[model samples]
Target: MADLSVNFAGISSPNPFWLASGPLTNTGYQVMKAFDMGWGGAVWKTVGEPVINVSSRLAAIDYGGRRMMGLNNIELISDRPIDDNLREIAEVKRRFPHHAVIVSLMLASDPTLWSDMMRRVEDTGADGVELNFGCPHGMSERGMGSVVGQVPEYSQQITAYAKSGSSLPVIVKLTPNVTDVRMPARAAVAGGADALSLINTINSVMGLDVETWLPDPHVADRGSHGGYCGPAVKPIGLYMVSALANDRRVPVPLCGIGGIETWRDAVEYLLLGAGAVQVCTAAMHYGFRIIDDLTEGLNDYLDRKGLASVQDLVGKAKHRVGDWNDLRLSYSYKTVAEIHADQCIGCNLCFVACDDGGHQCIDRLPGQRAPVVRKDDCVGCNLCSLVCPVPGCIEMQDIDLGLVETWRQRQSRVGF
Candidate 1:
């Protein structure tokens, strides 16, 4: 059996799965529930000088019939009192000492505010603090959140301030809105960030209704650009994490964030060099129960792959990545699909589609037997692979188009 336990920056968790700082971690009750549900740790939501959050501060995006798979929010940091948050953090840590109860915080334009907040939160005895430099909406307009992240100088100075104020490890949570991610990343490390967590929600607004002319979850008949997170943000997050991990310029422990709902997503982040993977949107949308799957699923994955621990997977993919020219240009493949006899109902959907909408690649008789794939003419565009009822019924295969440069040479010689 593999040991999933990890000692990250002197903070030990049973695993590398941590709930991110968001709506789900807004309180001790929520954090406790998440811990009970098997999350390795939790970063308490961004707590500021008691905020006055607005009514209906959330908006969403729907694509492919999935609602809130990608979420947007205008919600500010924790609207609760500062002392109350600290009390809860103190109590939660005493009760669940094994779990990493990280305090997340955001505050005003003044250095004194940052200094005071870090000192106050540190008194709670939390394992660490993640400076919220990456909320894309609401707070950004006030010279905080993503606004702070966009300016490298601001990030550097504030990080230095936070480092000065905190006794615990200070993890700078970065925004994705910067021109180049590495620039801000470098600034944070330079200013003394103990660790870096990245890819906070992006700015986005969902489409509007046609007849009503109002965007969904209407906020006084209008809505502002909100922080976007969830499945949609995973790719962007992965790219940022990989870029920083692979870059020799930035050398800080990374806490991977953005759109991770499952263990596979966590594994990918760790393989790309994250010490831990954080969840925000998934917990907001699906509630804290998903942590069970996040933990057990990763355990099963480790067992299957013969991985002895979570650290074994971290940065595994970094070495495999190559420069542009190092990529194999000679390798080529054509799209192909193989139908499963058991899964196929012989609906001829692909046949009709190919006949009318696509190239004449699919074959089916009007009133005949099972629709059969004609390999000779099948271009492997995967149209048939889609519209199939059962998963794996139609498998997409890449057929060799065969030596493209050689074909070009023959054609040139014959002038064909």
Candidate 2:
């Protein structure tokens, strides 16, 4: 059998699927249930000084009427008292000794406070601590969360404080709001972090209310920018994960978070160099039962691919990622749209779009109500193929260019 287990930063879990720090992990009941449902780990909802969240704390963006395509929230860390969260962590870790229970924490920019909290969490027998420096909204306003995450100095200082206070491994959760994620990633490594988890939500406003001219999730008819998560942020999260994984200065293990909803999504993160992956919104939208699909799909996939374990798949695709300049400029293929006479509905949508927006390569047939691609004028752009209503009716046929050469090599050959 393909082993799905993972050991990220020395904290071994039955599998790489972990519940991210969010509403889903706010209590021990939720964490325990998630473990029972086959999640290998859970980052306990971020704990710190108590916070009072706004009445309307969450809003979402949809695509084609799907719910929660992108979620936005102004909520802060755990609203429960610190002692309560600590006690729950102790209890959950004691009950589920085999599962990875990582404590997520945030605090005011005081090193002493951070260090003290780190000490308290270490006593709970948790596997590790994730510094929650990435919450982007309410907490950032108070000099916590992404405020610290946005500054490399603050990130390093706080990470150092956490490491100094706790013998357990330290994982720094990074925010994506910054211009360059590598800056904070390097700082975390410099401060002795054992691993890094990212990316926290992005800064966003989830559309506006036309009636009041205010943003959605308006509390008392007013609103503020919130942190965005869910499926929409997966690409951004993957990009940041790849960047950190490829950075020489940031060698720590990575726990990928943000918009991971399925086993396939988890595979993409692993192939891009993540040691483990965390999930939130998907579990929020569906239920913790989704872990069934997450684990089963991954296990089946690994077996089919003839891999021994999930670790073998990690970072396999990293080398394939390259800068735009590194791309093969000379690789060329000419594809022309081919129309099937039988499948053509004579809608002429493809013809109209191709004629006006494309290279005007499509022509109406003289006798029939069908259109044909003018092969002489076609540059093989595939505009007609794309706009065609029939699926297999209009398809692009590739014209082999016979050779491939990079622009750099071509320039060198031409003596440029």
Candidate 3:
């Protein structure tokens, strides 16, 4: 069997899948239950001075049959007392000795407060600590979350404080609210962080309740922007992870988060250079039992690929990622839309899309039997192929143009 276990920043876990800090890890009971159900690790909900969350703190975006495609939350950190959380952490670690238990911490940027909290949490026997500088809403307003994370200097300073206060490995969780993610990532590494995790939710507002003329999840007919997560944020997370992973300047293990719901998603993150990954919304929507299929599916995939362990797959695709300028301008793949005679229903969607939006490649009228791809006008953009409802009905056939020269080579030959 391929080994799914991973050692992320010196904190060894049974596998790369860890329950991200959120509603899922808010209590010892929940954490323990998740471990029992096979989650390899858990980052305890962000702990700080207790908070009083509002009644309507969560709002979601649903697309037709898909519910919770994107989730927004105005919720704060763990509202439980610090002592109670510490006690639970101690107990959970004692019981699940082999599992990774990382305590997530957040507080004002005061060095003493951060250092003291780090020291106190380290005493709980947890595997490591994740600096919660990524919360984008409630905590940010309080000057504790993305308020500090958005500033590279503040992130570096807080990371230093955590490192100073504890010997335990420190993983700095980053917010995606900034223009450039690499700046903060480099800052965390410079401040002595052993590993990095991202992305904490993006700041967003779900739709407004147009009938009532109020924002969604309104407390009093008005709602504030909140942190957004779920499947919609996966692309953003993958882009940031790939950007950092490809940058050799910022060297630190990454625990990818945001919109990871399955084994395939986990594999994508790992191949993009994440040492491991964390999940929140999936566990929030489904249950911790999702880990069963997540693990089994990943294991099966690795076996089929003849991989010995999950570690072997990490960063496998990192080198393949490149800057836009590095792309091959010379290589050309000209494919034209080909319609299957027997399969065409003459929906005319392809013709309409191509004529109005694409290269006017497909020729069809209201009573036409089928859409024909006009070879000369076809740019091979595949727009017609995409809007077609039936699968295999519209196929893009490649046009083999013999040896080709790149723009760069052609420019050199002209010698401007």
Candidate models: Cα lDDT each:
0.82, 0.90, 0.90
- Any runs in candidate 1 off by more than 4 Å, and if so which? 62-67, 320-324, 330-390, 393-416
- Expressed as tens digits, the lDDT of each residue in 248-281 for candidate 3 is 8788899999899999999999999999999999
TM-score per model over all chains: 0.84, 0.91, 0.94
For candidate 2, the TM-score is: 0.91
Estimate, for each residue in 1-416, the C-alpha lDDT of model 1 and write its tens digit.
67878877768888888888877888889888878878889999898877787777777777889977778788889888888889999988888999988888887767788788877877787998888999987788777899989999989998888888767898899999877899889999998988899889887876678899887546787777888888999999998999999889788789899889888898889999999888888877888788788888988999999988888998999766645533323234466667666677777776787778767766665665456677767776677767676778788776665755444554565663
Error of 1 at 34 (Å): 2.5
In every candidate, how many clashes are there?
A: 2, 0, 0
Which residue window of length 10 is worst by lDDT in model 2? 324-333
TM match of model 3 to true structure? 0.94
Q: Model 3, which residues run further than 4 Å from truth?
A: 365-368, 397-416
Output candidate 1 Cα RMSD: 4.5
RMSD after CA superposition, every candidate: 4.5, 2.6, 2.0
Task: Give the clash total for candidate 3.
Answer: 0
Clashes of 1: 2
